[model samples]
Target: MSEPTSPESNPHLTLVDHPLVQHKLTLMRAKATSTATFRQLLREISLLLGYEALRTLPLTDTVIETPMQEMKAPVLAGKKLAVVSILRAGNGLLDGILELAPSARVGFVGLYRDEETLKPVQYYCKVPSDLADRPVLALDPMLATGNSSVAAVDLLKEKGAQDIRFLCLLAAPEGVARMKEAHPDVKIVTASLDEKLNEKGYIVPGLGDAGDRMFGTK
Candidate 1:
């Protein structure tokens, strides 16, 4: 991730507004939606968001032969992308993106928030060794306080990942602002930029605990 020249604001954030993504997000947000349905919708929506997240990946020409004739074709350049999920909830989005880019490298970072402090504590992390050679797409379902998100990126940067992007289902203004101040170079892609986070540090009117909702843990 490139260090942001502007510390006061973020110009890297992207809001995915595709109709299908919007519809799926709506269904997922409904209180009555079943666990199975919510998980399914998350996967579908992630596919759409993944397309947007990777839209600017570098491409190069490759020689290929078709039945009709031999010609040069545009193909992705550089090493395969590294997709790192921020653990449990991130896996929901990771699975969908894999459907779109099956050959991409995969990694995981496990973090759980300390309720009283509202800070992240890392428990596990295992990422590709060649992360510096490839662009990384970091997946997390919610950007609530942005602490965990920021921590995740911090570790990624420490691991030599220069090109990084964050994908989430919902984002709070507080979270976006925090990320801007911390990792200005990372672009954040989300389905909705919701209102402020509640007192306990959850996005208001946001889909609750993405992991629990997707895994039926709640």
Candidate 2:
């Protein structure tokens, strides 16, 4: 995929309009798609999104030995990355990103939204101690209300994370607005910016509850 398309509403957001990602996302959105297929498609799309999210990672010049002779090479600079999953749904995207970044340090922040208020409730959080030094990628399949996502980033920031990126399969305008208001400094990488959220805080025209479909849960 080439550079992501930045929307006028939020320049920090990058819409990954890659054809392959859109095609797989369509399959995943179909009501008839199987659980196994949805999971597989999510994994595939995660790799693509991950590619865009880390596209601007800093690089440094270094001397390397080639098959013939030594030469100057550019390589990834800075500390190992921290990939933080926002509990269950985030794990779906986490797997593929880990495959793309095998050496990244993994972390998890458990937060479930309250049905009535749609606010996040945290239960668990265990992240890398060096978050202040390493970049972080926070994962959640749906950026619905951006409640849980904002809460997750709050926790990461409290833990000393300076650089952070939010990753999702689909995002709604309300959620994106919420994220922008709460954490404008963080960049957002998503597959598609869909219509507004429904009355119950679900993304309209979305592929249903990502956690349930991905895990065969409700």
Candidate 3:
């Protein structure tokens, strides 16, 4: 595995360079990889990415027994996290993270891009009413242009998501810069940092459209 890259003087971006994550990402990046395999690999890699993203979660001491005597053990502190998915492709990453955080509260925000304008348009959104208090982990598989991502984070902030983190499988430098500039307060976690996006707004050398590849569409 290679060392993770971060922007100069920027602490919000985190590239997950763990060996297992890199291996899974390599498998997913192959064009020959089947949809079933791609989906499975995404799930596996998401788990690894999620582990790193949630590494700094607050912990508290709790009383527990080891079948013999009582002992104080570390447990998650504060309210359960709000895991909000940016719909469609985001669900791929969401499923795996949910496995790791079974007790987290779930939410969904649906947005689609306009091919011509390259802007995000929201179609649907539903989140917890008291989202203001809990930490938020916004899940999305690809961070391409960052328009939809920034839009999604804007909506999350509007709904009172103060401490928010963005998690994705892959990111282009363009998208990372856009997100950093637009929502500097939100941290980004991704498995791989790929090259630039092509003329059509697709990340070059990316795993194709994450949604299409995961679902075997077109």
- List candidate 2 stretches off by more than 4 Å: 1-6
Instruction: Name the 10 consecutive residues with the lowest summed lDDT in model 1.
Output: 1-10
What's the residue-level lDDT of 13 in candidate 2? 91
In Å, residue 1's CA in model 3 sits off its true spot by 31
TM-score list, all predictions: 0.95, 0.96, 0.94
Instruction: Please name the candidate that would achieve the greatest TM-score relative to the true structure.
Output: 2
The global Cα lDDT (0 to 1) of model 2 is: 0.92
Q: What digit string (tens of lDDT, one per residue) describes model 3 on residues 1-218? A: 12323555468888888888988898999999999999999888888898888988889999999998999999999999889989898888887899999999999999999999899999999998787788899999999999999999999999988989999998988888888888888899998778888998998788899999989986
| Alpha carbon lDDT at 56, candidate 2 | 83
Candidate 3 lDDT at 23 equals 88
- Could you arrange the candidates by lDDT from highest to lowest? 2, 1, 3
Q: Provide the RMSD of all predictions against the true structure, rounded to 1 decimal.
A: 3.1, 3.8, 3.4
Poorly placed runs, candidate 3 (over 4 Å):
1-5
lDDT of 2 by residue, 1-218 (tens): 12223377578999999999999999999999999999999999999999999998888999999999999999889999999999989999998999999999999999999989999999999999989999899999999888899999999999999999999999988888888888889999999898878889999899999999999997
What's the CA error at residue 171 for candidate 3, in Å?
A: 0.6
